[model samples]
Target chain A: MSKLDQFESVFKAASKERFHYSPQELHSILVVTDLPEHEAKLYTDRIRDYLPLDGENITWATLTGEEFDDIGGLFEGIEKYRPDLICTYRNLKSQGWQWPYSLGEYLDVLTQATTTPVLVYPHPEKKEALEKLGQLKNVMAVTDHLAGDDRLVNFAISVTPKDGTLYLSHIEDKRTFDRYIEVIGKIPALDTDVAKTTITQQLLKEPRDYIQSCRDVLAQHESSPKIEEVVQMGTHLDEYKRLIEEHQINLLVLNTKDADQLAMHGLAYPLAVELKDIPMLML
Target chain B: MSWFTWFASSPTSVPASLAASQPHAHHAVSLGVTLFFLVLLILMILSLALEEKLHAKKSVIVGVFAVVSLLLADIFGLLPLSQAGRFFVENPLHEKIEMPVYIPAIDWGVVAIILGSSVFVDVTSRSGLFSWIAIKLTKASNGDPKKLLTYYGVMTVLFSAVLNNVTAMIIVGSLTVVSLEKLERREKLLGFLLIEGLLTNIGGLLTLISSVPNIIVGNAAKISFAKFFIVACPYVAVATALTIWMGAKLFKIEGLTNEKEMAAANEKVQSFDENDGIESNGFFWFATTMTGLFVGTLATASFLPYIKDLGMGYVALGFALIMLIRYKSEADKFYQAVDWDLLAFFAGLFVVIHVMEHAQVLALIGKGLSVIVKLGPTLGSGLVLISASAFSSVTDNIPLAAMLAKILGNMNTPSSSGLWWSVIFGANLGGNLTPIGSASTLVAVTIIHKHGLKLSFGEFVVKALPFALLQIALATVYVLLFLR
Candidate 1:
């Protein structure tokens, strides 16, 4: 409780962690699927058309289901190619996609085990994945705790086409918020009302402030996508689903890695599992 | 050298059961009948122990056994069927009169206390008091793993002393997960959780009403709430500190080496914003004050005029009623949240034990236990503690505590005797021996697994054995040096 320590705490509380934006260049893209090469070629062509990398000399590689036996073999293929971004659909090397309960073990491990950002295309069997081709104009970045997620924002911005709209959506889970608030209500010292308002504002404030910073920085770019922020407190899945439909978002960008857990982040897994018709960029 | 000599020489307080005037007179039954009832009791315990594997609810299993035992007892003419509405027909003076046969056996005082405490704690928790204190403790540690371990360990014990073990574990275990994750020290989560789980049992010993076993044994022994706290606090403090120290060493948790790292960690945790959990200022203060009053009232219930007569159970139920007034419209929610399965299990177990008593099953066990007590005070107490601890590690401790309390009561052992303390300590501390041993430890393992960490049953037992053994050893020495 020294003066310096007190000052450090005050400073840390006041200063929010801002998003650091850097343009991510896609030098090579790997398209992976469980279809045959001929069928995979058809899907890869559709992916190439859908992606915003129109004029770049990007090395494109396709690995059909037969190319790898398991998650290990898939990782080996990925290590050999060393793609800047891996373009794939959910339920790779598994029949889980049909059930919509998971993203299959391959994608689950792929998202967390590697540092490479994954551009998750909708399953090839889905008509929406085919129809959504050549439509990467409306990109949206979603997060449960949206503050300090610079990499996620950067990836979303990089993939968005010029003159397209980039929606930065932050949904503070109301259930979780209320749960903590309920615990606070039992505490004698805390002014529950002040806590309710101040904490809610603070929780939402960090992300809102970071999103504003994004707007300010992106405003300077000559051909940057127009930014729109959708920040509120609500159930994540329900809110995100509503926002996606309301905005007709073409691609959803989110972070998949949880620093403390081995599994994919709690919010990310359900979103990845349920939103099968939407292409999502998992970082 | 005989148990009778030891019992006669010992200075003991009059237990409530003994004061109530031996409700049912002990009668000799045929050996075959005694063995059958004993096997029935053993079967109930075994079924309860394998509850998870059997995929049968505890309440259902015990309820089935209770019905079977009652039917057999009725057939054998052990129960006075004509006096079904009376607990004790000997109460011609109307001291303990007019209760249904099953009602008297259930020990409604214990049930009331559990229900009341459960409702009160559940409602109080809705105010976010526990989480606020937890986050504050986290911030206080400045994100140092070693400091965090110590603070969380002590908090686990204190919380368990007031809250039930499962609730205590959930609150502290969750915060541990969040705090460790924030500090980027998730690698230490398993150790923190394991230590917290172990400390809960130690904390349970701190108060008469901290856990079910404590309530059962404490009530049976007629130990005052104040006395229970006084007797158990020293052991709890020492054992909690040792467990935390042992965990720190085993897990290799250490503090920041440099001031820079300390400052950074402090800054990181300071951003936690403890007040973020609070939702209602009015309710928070109300809950805080009520929690204080609840503990204060329970501790001094013996001194209070009306409450003294009614006992701690009435005080608990009364406080729960007061808390429920706030959510009077949604009272059903709190009621629904009550652990009905546990209450049902208690009811059924009481019936089974009551029937066993009718068949002289307790008298049979009492004969065997008398031999152990004849081994001299220190060695006898140590053996009982060891045996209870071992039995509790594998099966539900509630029935063990209840049965032992009855057996000891039947033998006319003193309330202040080391035997009573041994059973209390053994029943509470034995849970630390394995994940399945206690609800709190099981919860800790579940939390670890939920975070995608692998901590199998063998792994938990291996890691927790040292702490459990040391705790039981400390309890044995504590009983010998003080309680005896």
Candidate 2:
């Protein structure tokens, strides 16, 4: 109500949330799979070829099917190795992958209960799993809110080959956006058109700004992979599936943990379940 | 007169003249029966208070009490033998007259107002109007902690006045979380939320329909909607400002000390889009216009012809109907969203209170209250205000307000009496004393816990005691100086 208050309000209206990028270090990789020792070693070698963790001192460990039985055993194996990164396929020790409704109990609990970043490759039984992992040429990092996710973006960048392209994509869930907008529409004080446009712009703006910052930072490096931005508002699963197919993306990266709940991130579970033939890096 | 002689006289409807002539006249029920019913009433209140701990719904607790009261009233020959089940009593003339029963005991007017208002507010909330205003206010604070505290506090009051306290708290409390989180000032969240929660009770005193206690007390005193608002607005304004100031001082919520910090704070809030919540332009405009009309109609109901006789409840219901017509095909959805549990609780509560009246329990309470009144209007009113506030701080204020209003009414207290204002102020402001005192404050505590903040009950009481005491003291002075 005062002039000072008025000044502060106007100043706040002109300000925005800024994004900062931080690089991620991948020092150790642990590959877990439900295969015999020889076959597990073979799979680990194939993963080593695709992931661009080239540091000479970087450590690698393999946990075969015979090494662990249940969730507890898998956790014990992971505790023993304590790697910065865990690479595995969906439906780890279960036959649920044969039916396509869930990410299997092992992947579900592993994604949510642990702090270590997980790289979920397609179930090895899928016909296209090996073909999709042949080259990490197109690595796409997807999330509902992409701003300020420096670790996810950095991880995506680290995995992509220098000659490959990296896509930073953010899709605002249309259902959620509409639900909130519908609430606004019922309010008598707001102008509906203004709310719709401004909110849509603001939602898209954060991720775009963050992606631009990514571009700005990567521009300084001569050998950095090419960075591309894909931002849209749509139903997440359908839009993501379409984007992955359209880009012919080799590796998908997304966040799997929810800060508020013990369950896997709402979007990640479905994306992990439905995209059975593509390699995914779940953070 | 003999029982046959009294019963042979035509049973006529109780006249208003009888109330004026024998204001404190009560049935000659046995002291044992009266004490028994009194204990039952206390048990009901205790059960209602421990609703959460017992894990039983409030409606169920009150509903069981209502039925038990009726059965006991019937067993003790307190209930009339007439098929109508009216409360029959002999007047000074020894002529039998019938007092209205069960259905009339539940003030449909109060129930109507709550139901209608709930429907109307719920429907309008879907339009994102509250969210938009909240976002705009957040931006207006420029993300300054002190400024944010002030804006959110005032907004909480205004929302509580128009909407229910719980809705007001949720809308503002949630925005506080998001806004503070964005500014990277989560450390101030507990303070902001706690302050906003306390302010809701202060705001609830603004209008006649703002809270259940206000509605119960205001209706009993026959305070017109406009008069209720005019009388309480000044006190609410002062209390709100004082509470906000106290919260800011106690919580150390301060403005940016340096230019660079201020600029950064300003920048962070700019990202908040006020219009982000709106979806439909037509519905938004319609809801806004209707809300204005609804408030105007309620405030002017007594002055308007035809509506004056129908009372404010019809005005609320009429407006609710108009709004419901917008989504006629899906009207059931809004209806389903209504707080039926609250309505059922009120219904059962009123029935129990009605039986208490028949059993002469109210007259007993009135006898005690009369001693306080004899202390002289100023001192008496002040004592009443403080006492009601203290009682309300620890229990459900609705039943307290209802019982006190009935006692005052039995004592033939005038409509303009300061006693009515005392009850109003005490019933509304008392909730600030503890988290469990009111639904709104409890919600605030829940939000705090949900955000991973630790706020113990003793800690909340210690923090809130000063604000509650100051507000009650202010109300006492206001009643003595003006309303008395």
- The DockQ figures for the candidates are 0.03, 0.08
Tens digit per residue, CA lDDT, model 1, B77-134: 6763443322332232323333345656788889999999999998888776876787
TM-score of 1: 0.66
Candidate 1 wrongly placed segments (more than 4 Å): A1-146, A149-283, B1-28, B83-99
Choose the strongest candidate by lDDT. 1
Looking only at chain A, give the TM-score of model 1 against the true structure.
0.92
lDDT of 2 at A89: 83
How well does candidate 1 score on lDDT at residue A136? 79
lDDT per residue (tens digit) for residues B1-484 in model 2:
1111122113564453553345335346988889999999999989977888999888899999999998898788665345455445464575665554465568788998999999998788767677778888877887788998999999999999998898888778877877787789999989998999999999999999999998998888889889999999999999999999999899999888898888888877866766545568788789889989988999999889988877878888888888888788999988888888889999999999978987888878888889999999999999999999888888889999999988887777899999999998998888889888898998899889978999998999999999899999999999999999
Residue B435 of candidate 2: its Cα lDDT? 87
TM-score computed on alpha carbons, candidate 2 = 0.67
Full-model lDDT for every candidate: 0.84, 0.83
Evaluated on chain A only, model 2 obtains a TM-score of: 0.91
Interface RMSD of each: 11.8, 10.2
Model 2 C-alpha lDDT per residue in residues A122-147, reported as the tens digit of each score? 77777566755676789999898888
